[model samples]
Target: MSDTQPPRVDAEASTTADSANAPRPPRLGGLPLVGSTLSIARDPFGFLETARETGDVVAYDAYGTESALVFDPEVVESVLVSRADAFRKGEFETDFGELIAPSGVAFTEGERWRRQRQLLQSSFTPARIRSYAEVMVDEAATLVDGWDDGETISLREELSRYSLRVLARSLFDLPLEDDRTATVIRAANAVNRYASPRRLAIGGLLPSWFPDRVEREYEDAMADLETLVADLVAQRRAADATGDDLLSLLARAEYPDGSRLAPEAVRDQLITFLFAGHETTATTLTVACWLLGGDDAVRAELERELAAVCGDRDPTVGKLGDLAYTEAVVREALRLYPPATGVYREPTSDVVLGGYRVPAGTTLQLSVYGIQRDERWWNEPATFRPERWLASGTGTEDGGWTLEDDSDRPEYAYFPFGGGPRHCLGMRFAMTELQLALATIVRRVEFDPVADALEPSLGVTIDPGPAAVRVRPRREK
Candidate 1:
């Protein structure tokens, strides 16, 4: 279970390993070395379809390593939550640990991850996130102010800018005054494109001695990100201030041993927050806008809720709870296109999942994408229905919403922000950011899709495809 020990099976050995001795799972039959990689590369949904055809528990080879693609929610739960200690973040994440930065929650494991999580948990508490709402609302207003009525724009691009501004102000205590915001936005997109699965799979196959282009791109992006974070940290350190900002909290944070985080640790966490916090929230907001535009009923419902709660004033943390339909739209969007897409784990010991005995060291992929839409749990799996979330009486009785019942749903089926002790540290911050951005956008403008059909494309996060929307300012009544 030690982090330093490599898995027993080498990448090449996994390619030729016999399933007869090892537990055999259903598998797609096509090519020898590259099984379903083309289908997965072309369309991730299609790859899931192939996985379904094979069965809930299907086997596949990626980068010369055999992996089990577990689509069953219960089985996914076993790996992610119920028996989480039996699993570790798979080799794919480990290979890019340095690329993710050196010391934040994502790159660390075991005691290090636990210690960091403990120290950072207070920063993302619901109350703390609520305090950050004004920052989000202010930034959102700025974003909407720049848009003209009846003008066509990419929702994805706009939300990216908006979320980056929110993250910059809330997390780093830095205003999105000029080129800094643009640089962060560019770096995030560059990192996303470079970390696409197609590139990662190819890079995973290459030897450690080789320089991966994608890796280099990721490093360059991280370097820019580090410079921004380091400058911020140094400034805060010189001022000796403990301001009500995430960076200040981090800068002043002390370990149980009374030691401050090293500069590299600060840089790593800043990068983690930037990548994990903004990008996913931005994507969710963009998809929410697209869904609202495409469906008249949903848009009307959202507008009604927003008008009722917000009235003529901008949304504050107190007002956010009143936007029920807005929250519903966000929930449905996440269910349909979870930003994390999938949770990955590797078994520490032989374990039986979905009636198959997977050996120790087997890499496992828990498909949040597949399980969220699985017919077994949802009535109309493919439809955009926020009512389903309401039926369980878990979200909110009044206009105000809470996540009480979200956990009551089948475990891994609802991981927009992952699960277990290793769940995203900034979940509350991201949610607050999304809620404010979404409510402000709805209040200022009506949106309509420019494309006939909008599709979710798989990237580092699930992204909307080839879709621009026309935005119009709401008429004064």
Candidate 2:
């Protein structure tokens, strides 16, 4: 099974041990009150690098909380998988989840999160994701048809629209207009800014009710999101027959006692899916295209596979299994630039990690970006080589490549969608979307990077800043 596949989170064994004499992790020193907030705000990658120098488990005060930046893959697995019940979503996640999607599955803990996940799992089953394939390709084709040959465009901008369109039609069964897409883009940016280190640092000094400009914009954006969610819920409810879309499935979903989700609860799910469903996929595609643009051999290999499997026709659900190279490109891109950046958790009780005793309520930062690119787990870790995802084999019966058996790698070493039971609910849906959309677009056009370098900055997601590309029709069949 793919390591990304959900493992039994109910394993009786816990990784934590009672080591009362275990020393506290080495600390990453910073300012008295705000701690490393400014350092992180200025350069998150640099801050993470500094943490690496300190040790595998480096403790520091973040916004006055006892926090540690963990680099060891084993410790990461302990926190995310083996000893998952021993931790909860940290204060950062709880605060941001409330700002973005209160009462949604992303923030709720214990029984509430479990119940919500069970109710929603039906919509993301393998069969259900397969049902979304047609919509994914149709949106990709529409996006390609609109692009003029040799036109320079922002990949993030164009792909974000395509992703949102696919998300709307497939999940909500709603068609998007230019205006609605624009609204979502703006609102997503506003919400993302709230999690920035600078914002959080300043927020600590200000009272919650303070009427600051950033605060005002955030509230307005949230209001707009709430309005959008309300409208979608209303539309789905008024329909004559319930549809197979996520919103429709959620509308009729019931708990063990037969109680349906309240209106606000349903709204929260819509908003949560809206943000998670579209944004992460767009970031993945944007980076994939950017990486593909700079590499000739990889692009040629991708095109060869595309020709072998898809011919002149656009990608479809039936062809995805044969598009191994295309899937690898997406995987490699995610490995380089995971959308979540890192996972945050807090010890529910004092626990031992990396032979250190962590106090209860101490925040743990598991850097997905750091682990995926570590030299120990990945050879030539920084290179964009999709071939790494292929196993040592010749051509398939249909002349396609075979994907790698990643069981050799550590489980926590490559978790762009995260791991354990809290693994992204949309993991399958997002992969299917990226593969179908990528193959469809590549079959139609080729991209050249308009800018030589990608200035990656920290945000709610890794913003692929200034990723402009020139698009033209592919010359070869």
Candidate 3:
């Protein structure tokens, strides 16, 4: 499976075909004027689950615009992979593009996106990622050491700061100054709060001139973010862009035509990484800890695996392959609580999805959240079972557990970082970071969840709202 191409599905014809005569999808009943806007904002998980029950492809009105929520893996493949060019970013992307990374790889299309991806790909390669393992382990250790035994802490806040620290050191070659750390945290939270489904819907309905509190905070955050980025860029430039960090690489990299990213373009890419890189990984770590806290058996097995592979020493890049159980834990957590809840696309023209004709410009919300948890694909959809991702070793020298070949399920069924050419550039970086961080932290401290239940909020990423855990130091054997 090439990184640029998405996995092909068996039902390619029906998914990619433009069937003009195909009937419109079954409508998901909603309110008269506001349609499903209020319902979706109030309970996106429930609303999407209801949409799933309606059909593989269900239609509904959001405000005045008609939208489709796609559940079938084949249809998702068509939109994200096979006939991807037939679709563009959904309506929300317009908001993101203007406010976030307008010229960055995330929002750019066609040639510009490709060029930026090419330049950025070098920093995320497996070899390059491995080089950052020590930093990841060291940071995780620092984070764990900060917790007093029996102290309760908010996993989201602690992990978010840890992720930001790692990103700054590993990629930017900039140490997060103590005074600026709070600014980064506030800015990140402001952007995420503004991106909530409810706020987005309200912002869309209201006029641009409307003085909304959320948008106001977001704009102020962006201003602070701009200042932060300018300082970092200036620091890097003064050092002559000679470091091995991502910022240095982008500064010194050039296109085939001998052109380099302008200063503003570099800033855009920096912001893209800051917003996209830190939050998603932080949420994932938080959820992984939450899941581990509730499942003693699974957590014990994970700790055992860490002890066997990593021993008394910290996790290293070379031992990552042997930490199969640790990796599976991460995989299971992602399946249950994917940070990227859904992907949105709009058709460039009329297209058939599961035999339903969707009109041009109709927003298609690929339900990653619903599909990953669908009972049809998973045996026990709501359960946290890391064993599902492991297989008895076939060819390893030690015959230890290895990652299961995912032939039993659809390729898109467990895409935590999305798929196709637009798949996350930092997939390897993120996995390496999570696996190392989880192993490093778990080996030293045991977590007992303080929160009763995870109330997943639909934010920029799926937020495990207000979840806390009590940390107890593990007595050395």
Q: Which lDDT tens digits does candidate 3 get at residues 105-212?
A: 888887888899988887887888888888899999999989998999999989999998999889887789766766777887887788777886787689878778
Instruction: Assess each prediction's global lDDT (C-alpha) against the native.
Output: 0.73, 0.82, 0.81
lDDT of 1 at 35: 67
TM-score winner, 1 or 2: 2
Candidate 1 residue spans exceeding 4 A from truth: 1-23, 201-219, 392-411, 475-477
TM-score to true structure, per model: 0.87, 0.93, 0.93
For residues 1-477, what per-residue lDDT tens digits would candidate 2 score against the true structure? 112222222223323455365567788789888888788877888988878766777889888888888877778888888778888997868878888887888888988888899888878889988888999998899899999989999999999999999998887778988888887887887877776777877777888778788778888988887887777666767784267667776666556478777766777887888898888999999999888889988888888888788877888888888888898899999999998888889988777777677788888888888888888789999999888888767444454798985787877888888788798999999999999988888878889998878878876578887599999998774
User: Judged by lDDT relative to the true structure, which candidate is superior, 1 or 2?
Assistant: 2
The alpha-carbon RMSD values of the candidates against the true structure, listed in the order shown, are: 6.4, 4.7, 4.5
| Candidate 3 TM-score, true structure as reference | 0.93
- Model 3 weakest 10-residue run by lDDT: 1-10
> Which residue window of length 10 is worst by lDDT in model 2?
1-10
RMSD versus native structure for model 3:
4.5
Residue-level lDDT of model 1, residues 1-477, one tens digit each, is 112222233211232233224445666664677765656666778887668656777778765667778777777666677778778886766755556665778877898888888877867778778777888888888888898888899888888777887787766677765677666776777676677767765665579999777667667876776787777778887888467667876777567578777767777887787778777888888888888888877676666666667777777788766666677778889998898777778877666666565777777877788888887777788899876665354433234443234445566667777777787777778777778888887888878788887777785478676459888886554
